[model samples]
Target: MIESMTPEQESNKPKRQFNNLVNNPVMEDYSLRYAPQSFRKWSEYAVATSALGGIAYLADFAIGASIFVTYGFASGVWAVILAAVVIFLTGIPIAYYSAKYNIDMDLLTRGAGFGYLGSTITSIIYASFTFIFFALEGSIMAQGINVYFGLPLPWAYLICSLLIIPLVVFGMTLLSKLQVWTQPIWLVLLVAPFLAILFKDPGAYGAWTHFTGNAKGGASVNFLSIGLGAGVALSLIAQIGEQVDYLRFMPEKTEKNSGKWWTAVISAGPGWVILGALKQLGGGFLAFYIFGALGATLAVEPIQQLIKGFGVLIPAPFIALTIATVFVFLSQVKINVTNAYSGSLSWSNFFSRMLHWHPGRVVWLFLNVGISLLLMEFGVFGFLNTVLGFYSNVAIAWIGAVVADLVINKPLLKLSPSYIEFKRAHLYTINPVGFGSMFIASVLSIIAFFGVLGSTAQAFSPFLAIVLAFVLSPIIAILTKGKYYVARPDALGHSAEEGDTHALNCVTCTDDYETPDMTYCPYHEGDICSLCCTLEKNCHDMCKKPGVIEVSMRK
Candidate 1:
C-alpha cells in the first residue's frame, strides 16, 4: 500500500490530531489522567513546599476568632485540637493515594467507591469549597486594602479577585514558582508578630487562657460549646483536596528517595494541620489581645488583628498598616490562586461529565472567580459562622465516605477493590457504596444541624456525618457485595503489570494516547481516548453487552 501511493498523495495524508481540550498543559493539568511520570519532575521537597505555601491563609485567624468569641477559650481550645486531630488522621490516606497514584481528588474519589457519575456529585461539592474560600480570602484582602489605601471596598474586592487570574491561568507551572518564591517572606511576616508579642508581653498567654470571650460560660470549658466549636473547625476537613492537588505532582518514588519521599508526603500532606493548628491557636490569642485592646467587633477582623499585632513591632501606625496590608495581600493571593486553580479543575471534571463538553479549564477559572467576586460583594464574611457550620455536614460526609473506603471497606471488610480504577468504560454510573453512604450521612446530619434531632445533635452535626458515613460505607459495600468496584478489565487489559507504552490512535479524535486514557469503543470499532469517550454521549454505553450490569464486572 505504501509503495503504491504517490509521494504527493502520501504527503497529503492526515496527521494525527491531538485533542487540544484534553492535552493542554495549562487547562487540563492532568485533570482526567494519571500525571505522567515525565511531568512529575520536581524534587519531593520542592513540591511539598509549594503545597505547604497555600496553607498561609488568614481564614484560620477569622475562624479562630469566631469560634472563640462564641464558645469561650477553654471550649475553643479543645475544639481546635480535636478538629486538628481528625483532619490529620483523615488527610493521611487521601494524600498518600493521590501522590502514589498521580491523580487529583475527583479521580481519587471515583476509584475509591463513588463510580463515574457518582463522583461528579463530589466534583460539585469540592468546587463549592474552592469558591467559598476564594470569596472569604478575597474579602479579607479587600478589607486590608481598604485599611491601607482607603480604596472603596467594592473596588478592592475587584482588585483582589482579578489579581489571581493571571497567576492561575498557567496552572501549576506558574503556581509552583510563585509559591516557592514567596514562601520565605510569608513565613517571616507570619511568625514575627507572634514572636514579638510573646517576647514583649509574656503575661498575654495567661490573660488569653482566662478570657471569657463574649459567651456566658466564663473561663471554664463547656462540653456543648466544645462540640459547636469543633463542628465549625471541622468544616476545613476538605482542605486536604487542595493539598493533594499539588501533591499529585510528587516525583515517582524510588529506593534512592524513599526517605525524602515519605517525609515530604507526611509533612506536606496531613501535617499541614500542624501549622494550621498553630495558626488557629495564635489567631485565638491575637483575637483575645485585640479584644482587650479594641473591642469585640474589631477583634474578629484579621486585618485588625494583624495591624494591632504588627503595631507592637512598628511604632508608627501608618507603617504598621502598610506592613500589615502587604502581609494580608500576599497570604490571600497565595490561597486564592490555589482556590481558583483547584476550582477550575473540579468544574472541568463536573461539566465534562454532565454536559459532555469542556470549553477548557480556563473558562471555568473565570467563572469561579466571577462567582467568588459576587460573593465578596455580598459580604460572605458577615455570615461566616453559619455558612461554615452548615457546610461542615456535607463536607464531612463526603470525606468520611472516601476515608471509610480507604481504611475500612477496602482492607478490614475486603468489600472494595485494592486498585483504583477511574476510567468511565470500566465504572458504573453510580456506586451505592460511596454515594449511598454520603447521601444518607449528609441528609441525617443536615437534619441534626437544624436541631431536628435536638440541641445536642445540632451542635455535633459534623460529628454525626463522620460517624454515620464511616459506619454506613462499609455496610453498603457489603450489602452490594463489592460488585460495583470495577466494571471491566483495565483499558489495556494488562496495563498495570506491563507499563502501557503502546500508543493507540483514538477513532474520534484521531489522536494517539497512552493506554490509561484510551478505551475500547465498540460503537466506533476502534480504540478511543477517554476525552473522546466522555464526549461521546450518543454511544449510550453501547460498548457494553446488552442486559449486562451497569457496573462492569472485572474480566
Candidate 2:
C-alpha cells in the first residue's frame, strides 16, 4: 500500500462534488469552513471596525454589576482588572494565529493540536458560548421590550431571537453595515448616562468605591471575593473566539500593511478586553448609583441601571424609559447578531464533523437561534452567574490548551509543528497534547469547583484551568513525542511550506481554493477543499492505511 501510489494514480482521481457558492451567497463568510486568504477581500480597517463593534454589547455592564453587587466595589474592580489582563494575554496569540492564517477559531483549533475530530468538542464549546450569550443578550432585549412596549415576556423572547436571523443570515456583509452604522449611536448612548452622572453627581465615584458589596466582606477588598469575581469574569474569555471570527477576515499582513495589520489585530482582538474592562467598571459605578436609588434588588439589572442614570438627565419617567429601552434594544441587537453568527459557524463545524453533512451555515443559524430562544424562555438571565461560573472552567481549559500550543509548545518545546494543518487527511483524530491537557484541566477544575479540592480552589477554578492546561500541554507533548500531531506526512495537501497565494482546484467541490484550504482526497483522487473533505465521510480511511486511522482514534 505504501508503494502503490504514483503521480499518475493520484492525478487520475475524478472530481466528486460541485461548489455550492452560487446557492449560498453568504457562504463567502465561510462559516463551518476556513476563511482562506483568497476570500479575505475586506480591508483591515473594515474588518477591525466590524470586530471592535461586537464589544458594544451591554453584557459587560450586567457582568460588572453582578460582580460589584456580589463582591463589592474594591473586589469587583480588582477582579475585572485581573480578568482583563488574563483575557488580554491569552487572546493575543489566538487572535494573531487566526488573522495570520485567515481561519476562524474552529479551524484554528483544529491546527492548534486538537486535531480534526478533537476540535469538534471545542467547536461545541464555542457554539455554547455563542448561544448562552445569545440567550443572555436576548433576555436583556426582552426585558427592555417588556418595560417599554408592554409586550409579554415570552413573545418578546421570540421576537428578539427572530430579529437577528435576517441580520445574521446574510452573514458579515450586512452585519458589518449594521455594526458600523449603529456604532456612533451606541457610543453616544453608552457614555451619555455615565457623563451625566459624572457632571451631576461628582461624589458618586467616591461612594461607589467605598460601598462594599452585599457579600460577607461588604465594602472590603477581599481576595477570596476577588478570586470568585475573576472566575466569573473569565467566562468572557471565550468571547475572544467570536472576535476572531471577524478578525479572520482581516487582510493578510505584509510589509506595506504590517503596521495597520498589527493595529487591527490588537485592537479588534485583545483590545476588546480594554473596552470590556471599562464597561465592567462603568457597570460597577452604575450599579452602585442604581443601588442608592432603586435598592439592591433592581440595581444590577441593566435596564434599571440605565434608566436610573438617564433619569438624572431627563426628569420625565416616560422619556427616560423610552431612552433606556431603545439603548438596551440596540445594544442587544448588536451583540446578538454576533452571537448568532458565531454560533452558526461553531455549530456548522461541530455537526459537519459529527454527522459528516454540510447543510450550509444558514441552517445552523436558525438552529442556534432556536436553542437560544429556548434558553431565553427558560430565563437564562436569572442564573447568569451560575451558568457563566461553571462555563468559565471548560472555556479556559480549551483556550488554555490552544494558547499553550501556540505560545509555548510550538515555539519553545519544538515538539509540535509550527504551522497549522487543519485538513482531516493530514492530522490525527486526537492529539493527546491538546485534547489530553484540556480533558485533565477541565476535569480537575470542575471537581475543584465542586469543592472537592477546597473552597480556595473552588473560587480559583478558572485560574486552575489555565495553569493546568498551560503546564500539561507541553508536558504531554514531550511524553507523546508529538507523534500524534500528524497521522502521516500529506505531501499532496497545501501546507505552510506551500505559498498560500496560489489557487488550487478542489477535486471534490470543483471550486478553486487557496493553498491552505486544499487537501489531498484519496477517494476523489485529487486535491479537495477542506469543507468537501470534511463532509465526505464515505471516504473513510482510504487516503491513509487502517493503522493510521487506528492511531488517530485512540486516546
Candidate 3:
C-alpha cells in the first residue's frame, strides 16, 4: 500500500515562480542548477582561457613576499612548492568531477558526500574565501591608486568594488570574451618586468637566494618556518572552487575531442597552481630586490615590487610607475570579477537551502562585494599572513573531505555513488561522512592552530586538518554502511548515459531541463526541476518515506 497525490491535492499545491533575473539565462548562468548540454556551447579552449584568466590576481605577489619576509629563502621557497603540490593533487579530482558532471563545486559537494543541506556550511566557507580574496586583491588595487593617481585608499576601494559589478552581472556570457581579449596584453605586461630584472640586475638573484628576514636562523631552512609558511599558502586551497565555477561550462567530451577535453581540463583545472607557484616565486624575488629601498612595509606590496622591477628596464620613473599601476588595475579587475561571480554562486546555494528562496545570483553578487569593500576599508592587507593562516584550517578540512569521498570512498571503497546525484529528491538532508569528518577535523585543527596542542601542532595545523579529514571520511562511510548517501534511489533514468540529450519538462516551472537536472516528484505527479524540488516546502520529503513509491513516467 502506497500513498499518492490526487489531482485535487496537486492542484492546491503552490506553483513555482522565479523572478526575471533567474529566468534570464545570461543573468542566471544556471546558478542553482546543472549546466545543460545546450548551454555548454563554448570550445574547450575558450572555457579553459576564461578559467585561467582569474589567475591574473596580484595576491600571489603579496603572499609570496610575505612568506619570504617571515621565513628565510630556503623555507619560503620550499613552502611555496610544497603547497602548490598539495593544491594540484587535491584539485585534480574536484576539477575532473565538476567538468565531467557540468556542475559547479557547490552542486558537486552536495553529491560527493556532503548531502543536500549538509553542504550549506561549505557554501559559507567557500563564500568566505571569495570575499577574503576579493578584499585582498582590492587592497592591492587601492595601494596602486594611492601611489599613481593620488586617490585616497577609501575612495579607491569603493571604485574598485563597484567597477566589477557590471562585468560580473552578465556571468560567463561576457567573462569568456573579456578573458580572451585581455589575456594577451596581461601576459606581456606580466613578463616584461621579470625579463628586465634578469638582464639588468642579474646579481639580485644571488642576493635574493641569501636573503633572510625575520626567520630564527638566518639563511638556513627551519622546519617550523616552512610549516608556518606553507599554512599561510594553503589558504589558497579553496581557489579550486573558483576555477571549477568556470570549468562547469566545459563542453561535453567525446572520442573525437577527448584529447583536447582532457588537456583543457587539466590545464585550466589543477594546472592553475603551476603558474601560481611561478608568480609567487617571482613576487619573492621582486620583494627581495626592492627590500633595501622600500623597507618591510612597502616591499611586500605588488605595486612597489613591480615599480622597482620595471625601473630596471625603464630609465624614466614616471613611465615605470604608470605601467605598474596599469598592470595592478588590470589584474585586480580580472580576479575580482571571478571572486564576485563565485561568491554569488556559493551564497545562492547556501540561502536557497536555508531559506528555500532565491532572489537571484545578482543580489548575492552585491552582497559579496559589499563585504569585501568593508574588509578593505579596515586595512585587512596589513594582517595578510594572520588572516590567511587562520582560514586555511577550515578550508583544508572541507576540501580534504570532498577529495576523500571523490577519490577514495567512491572509487576504492565503493561506499559512495558511481556518479554524482545532486537532486534534492534523491539526497538526504545530511550525510555524516563528509560533514562529520570536516567538523571533527576543523575543530581539532583550529585548537592546534591556537597553540592549545603545542607550538609544533600550531604551525602545522592545516596538515592535521587535511590528514584527519581524509582518513576519517572512509572510516565514517564504512561505519554508516553508506545508507545516508542517498535518501531514495533515482527513479529517473540515467541522465548521464552517453548521448542522452533528452530534455524533460519540469511540471512546476514549466521549463525544460536535461535528464540530469530532472527528478520524479510524487507530490507533483511528474518530473520536477532540481531548483523547484529544492524550493517545495509542503512535501516534507514524502518520497523518502518507507514503501512510498514515486509514480512511474515510463509511458
Best by TM-score: 3
Model 2 scores worst on lDDT over the 10 consecutive residues at: 546-555
lDDT of 1 by residue, 1-555 (tens): 012336686466443344575568765687666676667778998999989999989999999998888778999999999999999999999999888877789989998889999999999899999999999999999999998889999999999998899899888888889999999999999998888888898888888888788878788989888888998889899999999999999987789999999899999999999998888888888999988778777788899999988988888999888899999999999999999999998998999899988777888999999999999999999988899999999999999999999998877888787766777877888999999999999999999999999999999989999999999999999899988887765534744324454667887768666666677765555677777777677668865554233222221
Ranking by TM-score: 3, 2, 1
Per-candidate clashes, comma-separated = 1, 2, 0
Candidate 3 structure quality by residue, lDDT tens digits, 489-515: 777665453446679899999999988
Model 3 residue runs over 4 Å out of place are 1-9, 495-499, 550-555
Q: Which parts of model 2 have CA positions greater than 4 angstroms off?
A: 2-25, 546-555
What TM-score would each prediction reach against the true structure?
Answer: 0.93, 0.94, 0.98
lDDT of 2 by residue, 30-77 (tens): 775567665677899889889988888888988999999899888998
Which predicted model would earn the best lDDT? 3
lDDT of each: 0.86, 0.85, 0.92
lDDT of 1 at 208: 88
Comparing 1 with 2 on TM-score, the higher-scoring candidate is: 2
